[model samples]
Target chain A: MSTRHDIAAPPTEGGAAPGRPAPATGPTEADRRRRARLSRRWQRDLRWSPYAFVSPFFVLFLAFGLFPLIYTGWASLHQVELTAPTDMTWVGLRNYTRIFDDEFFWNAAKNTLMIGIISTVPQLLMAMGIAHILNYKLRASTFYRVVMLAPYATSIAAASLVFVLLFGRDYGMINWALDQVGIGKVDWQNDHWASKVAVSSIIIWRWTGYNALIYLAAMQAIPQDLYESAALDGASRWQQFLHVTLPSLRPTILFTAVVSTIGASQVFGEPLLFDANKGASGGAEHQFQTLGLYLYEQGWVNQHLGRASAIAWTMFLILIVIGIVNYVISRRLRASS
Target chain B: MTTTLTKPEDAAPPVRKSRKPRAARAGGHMHGGPIAYAILVLFSIGSLFPLVWTAIAASRDNNRLAQTPPPFWFGSNLFHNLDVAWTDANLGEAFVNTTFVAGVSALTIVFLSTIAGFAFAKLRFRGRGALMLLVIGTMMVPPQLSVIPLYMMVAKLDWTDQLQAVIFPSLVSAFGVFFMRQYLIQALPDELIEAARMDGASSWRVVWHIVFPAARPAMAVLGMLMFVQTWNDFLWPFLVLTQTGNPTVQVAVAGLGRGYTPDQSLIMAGALLGTLPLLLVFAIFGKQIVGGIMQGAVKG
Candidate 1:
């Protein structure tokens, strides 16, 4: 032991602290075995702990996310009712075929498209303008951002209800303001186009600031050096924005567009809570009904789970098609740029 | 555009360099113009006007709301209307139920996400890449696709109107995982973890002592964001929770909007009650949330 210490202690103490605390117990037989076991356990922990860390998310997601998605596809093939979800009879493509012929389904899809365009086009454009303004140096920027996000903080139910009061045909503050401004009073709920506009306005109010904030984030992420270099080259502010800011923000713009599109396609609460009498129908003539509301009406109101599943699947397919289209367009744009 | 230039240092040991704000940036010290302020003020007013109107409508009687011009100012009937709507719509119970659910969901999601995010950001493991891709892919799957089956599960398990109906499904968030992973990848230094390991710290010890402290700021931000999201979530809670039996704030407020009471003031009161909590949260945590969103957006 003394000879081994003479050989090992000098080397160990050379790079270590002036005096080693202790010998850390001699490398006796049991100690070596214990050290080996500890290393094995350490190696095992290193290799497997990551899986353990990530398993809960995977487990929950598989049960809640993936399984349900595939099951919805399965349930779409059978005749099932809400009253007895266990009961199933094979219907082949009857549900899909019926959805194709369903006039209300077509109308709902068309309204969804209309509202999506109405809300998204104006919203993104306004968001871009607002984000540009926000990116400028300002006092109390946080206050402005928080205030702008008020509508996002407001729940869809609450926002829709407040909007319903504001859009009242006879007594609404909006109509009164319009009258004061030399415009005639208009029926917002009863008129199909008016209802669509009002509903789209609610979406715009809720989301424009959020998208603006997102755009602002993207803009801020762009280094000021880019702008400085552009300025050195005598590029005007507009030119610099076009050349530097917009290009850097391409991915962010695409992200927001995809998110907003998904939101619009699955818009359920605004139209659901718009008019009480024609709640699920979206209006008296089902004019403002979206595919989401129509699905709810089919499954919950009419108790036809099978049909609703079909509708759900149809919406999924439509979203996939839209996603692919978006991808292709974005790719083409990227290549051209 | 400058990302390529900066990408090298990103993989280097943490620099601990703080990012300069836009005002401090050399070239662009210019403040906003008058037109910019005017537009921003206009937008802010537009953003806040509906909420203000809700209070005004709630404070006045139903008749006042149906008049030629809506009430533009507060009236004495605010508390009376609030009380009536509170009981009428079962909002008290809703507040309790929603708070508990949101709190539990936020806490669990934060905890789970941080660990998983650390794993993804720092650790080398099998299936990490594929798993992360799956998480991102899952974000694209709309809730409509899952709700039908979830509804079935809730019904079959006789969990209708229970908090777990909303809480369990919400315990996992793809965005939360992604957000935390992005934050940790930059926030945490590899040298720190290695030092801890050199000190004979186990992975568990490294997580508890090293990772958690480094991750605290992000954890707080994520928790608040998740709380707000779960609090405001409508579709699932509306389906499972009944208005009278058990309700979330969204469900209860919706019940009021469904014309349970024909009084418009009462409905406004409920809507105001439902939204006030979140607005207060936003008011207090506004800066942190703003920072968090910007941080998440950058390099995300």
Candidate 2:
């Protein structure tokens, strides 16, 4: 096996091929001994350096990340509340059982999945298209790329609030524009499906640019030779993209998909802001409620600690399952490739 | 490497032919071609319209805003609305509180992430591989899962309703550390550190002088992300900052929509104010923000 030095190149070094350079001359005995000693010292340093470097992350994770996760699992098994005294009572699986029967829980789960599908499918497809357009030679490409990320960089609270005004039924700019173009105003926040659509549009707008940039990077990494080969076969631009580029982007595609799914599952701020009229219930009917919002309302608003903890664990489980599925699919794709 | 040398000849024809259409279009003076400049101009306007509208709405009275085709021009109610929002919601307090929380949280995050990142990139220690994986693995665990437990922990510590509750939980971010590490590893050279070490500089001194300056670009990017995230964060602050006067901008904005019968102009004004700093940051460091985001995304 190659030594650690062989693998120490930065990932951005363009994956240089190995075994090309040969030593210029045979080493003298003294030089060989010095080199061997240096290598041994380097190996010793390598063994300890990585651990010291990564300790903060693990330390912080243990306190903030892993500990909280384990605590949530423990909290899920008890019947508790915010104001209730901390008494040890473990009703195993009862929290999960209650979740199955809870109408709000199911609504939140269904809404999460619905919004996930609505946002993820088009958001990614459009992102792929945008990335493709972006990858081509264009004037002011840098400016456009910068402008594209503005929405993502902007605060979610701010964007959702802007959308709230834009999607207003009576005096919204969108309705005003639509009226000019001979279209009628639509009630954006009142109706269940309409509100979801409105909320989903915000998600799509904010994230499409981010994912597009990711895809653009992956696209840049694809070998120019592959496109050249396809072109030599009399392939059109579309053909080259479909045959050479899209397949090359599968890993990134899966990555973004899983990440988007996780994001969608926890869709909070938009729905929270959008349903501001209903006072944090995520709508009067809870139509636009998601798992994250539901969890918040339960834990903080209603003070249903046990149920909220259960919902959180369930969301975590779902995310893990999705992540595992994504991993499996990516591995299969890699193996096949 | 072999493929790079061999493919140029084969690749030449298609690229040359593909250029023909663009050249033809340019020659024909097709000013508004399918890839129209107009579309770009329109989208830019669309992207910025809400902000423009907010300014107009903020300046207008409720009467004017309630007009059929809402007043597209400004009116003389900016001070009146500001006064009402201020007195009604104590928005001024919220602003101060928010600035404090976001500022402190961002500073701490930058400090911790930098120290941790430098160590990860340069320091030699045991169990580094497992620790690195552990940190990376935490990235996959959604924040929602931990919210409940974190809230409970905060409650146990009696830190609920305090700004520390908001700032402490947010101080450690995986992405911040990851980005800082990546940037430092790439931007800083081993020779600089070796020289610093030869000069009898301690590890901390070497990092403070050498690594920190080299990591500014990445620090700016991480700082921007953290600031925007903290400023805009809604759920945690909303939960912890149950006190009306202590609300962050988001919680305050959401309260505006809730406490009053949803006034478009007021909400627009508030939202506009909330988003202005972010927009300003983008405007100032638009290039850096773009480069950082693209770099971070690419690596991810």
Candidate 3:
């Protein structure tokens, strides 16, 4: 990282004064000669200074951001025992093969998808609804917007803890509210379905407002004439909404969908903190163990770096596919509309 | 729906009959009467309930919290809970560590990304377009997927258990650079750079004098986003800082809740303590935060 300082290296003699152009004439007086030299230096510096200016991001990215990902791919091909450095064995595709056969990996992947779908679908729909409401001439709109985003500002650790307590079996508020409506006791932690719902609820609670605000911004950008034209065509309120607003918000909807998908697949802290007794296992039976936590459990907890690297590569591949699909869909939507 | 306003231009008026011309009244009840307010207020209460409950729980003892239909009012145990969280849960050390890490990291992100953003937006250079595209492309690849190799890199550097392990990797965010670049492209004019050059100002001088000051607002938004993100960051820190007394606030809060024999009151207090700084930030910069999100969403 100390190499980052080189980005601000002192300008060379020919690069001493940047951003100034060189003189056109060859022969000159001493003062002119000196000024021309200085001007030439500035021109040279200007030619290359953008590289210097942008080096920090690349330098840091190379060291910390990109290298780790590449190293993970390399390590995934080898059986590197973390505790015994000298015992590394070249095992091509074995780790990936083993992961394919591992139930925990599949389980974690399943839970990740389940929670991702359950949490993201409802959350996005609700956000669109809320954004729709806020897009109107509401009273105290700023106050509502501010309050809506308050949950987003809270730390996941804190928010999940609050939810964990709220999801408690005997003394939890959720169950208490349920009981008043004649529902039975819910073992939120132990029951597999209930635990997933609890984890998803925390995510939905934390992010719905954030997505809503984004939707609202997109909604506001829709030209007023579009809505008016639809209204004048004898379209009902619902027809105008379906034709004018939803269609206009297609790109934004796709953007949020992809962003939320990436976020949902990486869900971790909530489940880890939600089940106090289970630690990173997610639950007593690993009921809600997401792929993110699975990667952690394999690498750090179990000291299986090779398998963890495999998992990391798998996640990377999954994200790449999803990202490309999202890009294509968004482009198609833009082209169509 | 029943309004007979047929003209396309006049259609905007009858839809929003009372106020705010051409607001998206595609849905019925666009005027948002008391019922809309009621629904919005209900959702707001639901959104705030957890934080409110956390505050209420933080003031109460574990005995009261353990009761069925747990105590909903404030108790006299606030001091005790704070003390327990500070000393027993090691939240004080975590607080200091998180503040140092988040503060320094946010500052670095703002400074570095501002320069890089200016360069990307205004500078003409070889491979500038390719590099910009590369930076944006990396945004799709999340750090979580590379956590394993990142851990190895830290281990090779022997930086595990050190704050640098957490802070260094986060100093330059692609999203921050992208955001700042997008903002600078719109906010800055090439004429300004050209004028500075005509006056024989060095590139560095031009950036510092003309660009930095002009980009301060965008820099502030990037700084706030970075600070909040770093402060809330969990998984990376949780992996690196295995030592007990050296945890960040979020990790310590996780530990408080992760244990089997956890004290509910202490966990509540820790959660509140961890969240207080960011909540204060939100209170002051709520509008900017919303704006930042919209900007990212629109461009993204």
On DockQ, the stronger of 2 and 3 is 3
Among incorrect, acceptable, medium and high, the docking class of model 3 is acceptable
lDDT of 3 at B242: 57
Measured against the true chain A, the candidates' chain A TM-scores are 0.90, 0.85, 0.88
> Against the true two-chain complex, what DockQ does each candidate achieve?
0.48, 0.27, 0.35
Indicate the DockQ of the complex predicted as candidate 1.
0.48
Q: How does model 1 score by TM-score? A: 0.93
Candidate 1 lDDT tens digits, A96-205: 99888999999999999999999999999999999888888887777899999889889899999999999999999999999999998989998989999999999999
- Predicted model with the maximum lDDT: 1
Write the residue-wise lDDT of candidate 1 on B66-139 in tens digits. Answer: 89977889999999999999999999999999999999999999999999999999999988999999898777
lDDT of 3 by residue, A230-271 (tens): 778989978988988899888888878888899988998888
* A183: Cα error in model 1, Å: 1.7
Pick by TM-score: 2 or 3, better one: 3
Candidate 3 or 1, higher DockQ: 1
State the C-alpha lDDT per candidate.
Answer: 0.85, 0.72, 0.80
lDDT tens readout by residue for model 2, A1-337: 2333333322222135243232366757785575566555545554554454455556766787788888888989998888862653688999899888988889988888898898899999978977776666556766766677777765677678778877878877788878888978877787888888889988988887778778876776666667777888999877888998889888888878878887898898889888675645788888889888888888777887988888899888888888788778978998999
Candidate 3: what's its TM-score on chain B?
Answer: 0.86
- In candidate 2, residue B151 scores what lDDT? 78
lDDT of 3 by residue, B53-171 (tens): 89899999887877777777788888788777877668888889999999999999898888888899988898989999999887777888777777776777788778999999888
Clashes in each model (backbone N, CA, C under 3 Å)? 0, 8, 2
